[model samples]
Target: METVKLGIATEYIPGRVNVGLYVSDNGARLIDSGLDDEAGRKIARMLEERKIPLQRIVTTHSNADHCGGNAFLRKRTGCSVAATKLESVVIENPFLEPLVLWSAFPFGELENKFLQAKPSEVDLIIENSGIVDESGLEAVPLPGHFLDMIGVRTPDDVLFVADSVFSEELIEKYAVMFVLDVGAALETLDRLIRAEAAWFVPSHAPASENIVPLAEANRKGLLRVSEAVLESCGEPASREKILQGIAGRFSLSMSVSEYVLNSAAVGAHLSWLRKRGQVAPVVEKGVLLWRKTR
Candidate 1:
């Protein structure tokens, strides 16, 4: 965990998932925790060594990688946890993540910490879009990665965008980015393009003064996944068949967890295409299949 100071009041620890730290009159507040107990411990120790107070933690979403350290941090520091509505429930009940991913009670493999984090309590639920009263931090709605994912804009003019955008290398490495709403994700990119921030920090990407290029790269990646799914539907295909075609096209070999995540992502793309009248669902011989509409 390397802490890069973005401003006098803002600093972020870059990891597989970056954690944002903002110092206010009350104390220091974190944007999101890292992947596990060790990460939380390191963050706690970092603050303690610097003599910085840990007062609040605001998670961007309910993804295990983003909030996995919440329980550990909260337990050690007694800091208040805040998240938007859709995320708060799953953060408090971590099992819901794998459960929803599997569309049922998750199997043994899906129950791992990679898919489910240790549950933590939330003290405040943020408004859809505005300044969080207690922290005085602005919450920018960057939904579509998960249900109600948001980016935090510190008073110092640095924006901590969650997983709304990914680096070009990451997009190229994993062609099929995880998304719950393709349309919303694209819209969020548009929003980011218009944002005026001195520095932008994405959880999965490097922080930069200019984020438009990264946003555009991420947009292209989403289009690539959507095109792949659309091409696979040249022949009417069931949901599983479409997923299989995607894996084959990407040379992806998956465990059950990967399959579930990709399946959800593909489903979201299909939904987006359907909404735009680019695809349609057809039932033949009692089997539902998705086919290109236009």
Candidate 2:
């Protein structure tokens, strides 16, 4: 991962999951760690080369990819870790992630590192939005992709928007982005549309001076998925059938892990639509089915 400077006080390492570096009086704090021990070791080497002391790690969310390196980083540097409540739980009990996804003790494949990180204790639980004085970073709530995900806004005006928006190329490649709450995701996008920052950093996407277009694209993507879910249920289909129709339309070839993640995402779309009175559920032959209601 290469570090790009946003300001004297702020820099970030760009990768599949971007990690923000913020300098404060105490020491250098990382916004998020990368995937695992290897990622943690690499980041530690980078910091050592620069002669920076690792002091704290502020995680955006509990996604394994985002916080997987926390344990190694903390072991290496004794850095304090901070995260929102729900994410904090998952961080502390990594196995809970796969449990939530599979709704039980997950199968062997579901227990992969992609779904669960090594447990890392959180030193700080961000109870409210605004400046978190410990690291001199502001916590901007950006819920949707995961439970209680937040973005970090640096003093230098660089916003680390964690998985709130994905690039157009990412959309074309993956077709469906994982989200836990489609309604909250859309609301977060709406909030981002009016936000201004010197630079906006989305974990999976490239940083940009303007994120409005990206936000709009996310809104469109969510709407498109919602519409697809609605259209796929023309005949009152079960959740599995709805998923099959959506996957077929997108021509998505998914592994078991990918299928479960996508199924959760599709379930979010259904919940959003149902909440808005755009869809309804029925019990047919003892199986739950969903149908569009205009």
Candidate 3:
């Protein structure tokens, strides 16, 4: 239902999941694929229609939505996939994603397409923040959304910021975005605001020439969510109770999938607060309870 932007050497495909596309005389490169095989098939068709050979896929993270098309595209066009070392681990072994969310062997509810993408091989592992490949694309470290997440800078100076910041509209719709580290995510938003770039393309947001405003909005959103967590923890509370408080605060109706993701987000906030000496957790009678300490 969305159209891929054309008439430029580098432009992002706009959809629920935006893909950064770069085409040169040599071959075409994509910043990320999309949700599943269907999305991958469409990408392959687009490149085929242009008679452009697909070269490498630079994956930003290992999230199912981000890397789901990896296997399909690689199989269809034989494109090499690149990602950070830790992300590559999950990209190749996707079960770990559901495993971490479930905190153990995941149940059937957690084993779905959104959480478990088809296994895809990662040919290149981005080791650090610099030129990722011979194509001259640079990798900028963007921690917090996922472990070892990095935004890619194309040669055209377009920054494909992967899941680091939410679009204002998305922020309004879902006030609390999923994050693995509240502290690191806030720091990343600040970094994005300060970074110099001709354009910043957030995966779920529109591309913008100036990203400071969007970055700041995301910062405030995260802060608000963190504050909500504190408000819920005036007294000792279990993780479920804390989640319930947050849901009521936001009036969110969650399915099981949303529950696990939001639960993880709550855990991240607790960890951040605990690190800052704002909250402490105690296991009393085998029931973990969190209480505000500061």
Query: In lDDT terms, how accurate is model 1?
Result: 0.91
Backbone clashes, each candidate: 0, 0, 0
Rank by lDDT (best first) = 1, 2, 3
For candidate 2, the TM-score is 0.97
List model 3 lDDT by residue over 261-290, tens digit each.
999999999999999999999998989999
Local lDDT at 266 for model 2? 87
Model 3 ranges with Cα > 4 A deviation: 1-8
Cα lDDT for residue 270, candidate 3: 93
Q: Which digits, one per residue and each the tens of the lDDT, describe model 2 over residues 238-289?
A: 8889988888888888888888898888889889889999889999899999
List TM-scores for all candidates, in order. Answer: 0.97, 0.97, 0.97
RMSD of each: 1.2, 1.1, 1.4
Under the 3 Å rule for N, CA and C atoms, how many clashes does model 1 have? 0
Best candidate according to lDDT: 1
**Model 2 residue 261 CA deviation in Å:** 0.7
Candidate 2, superposed: residue stretches over 4 Å from native: none
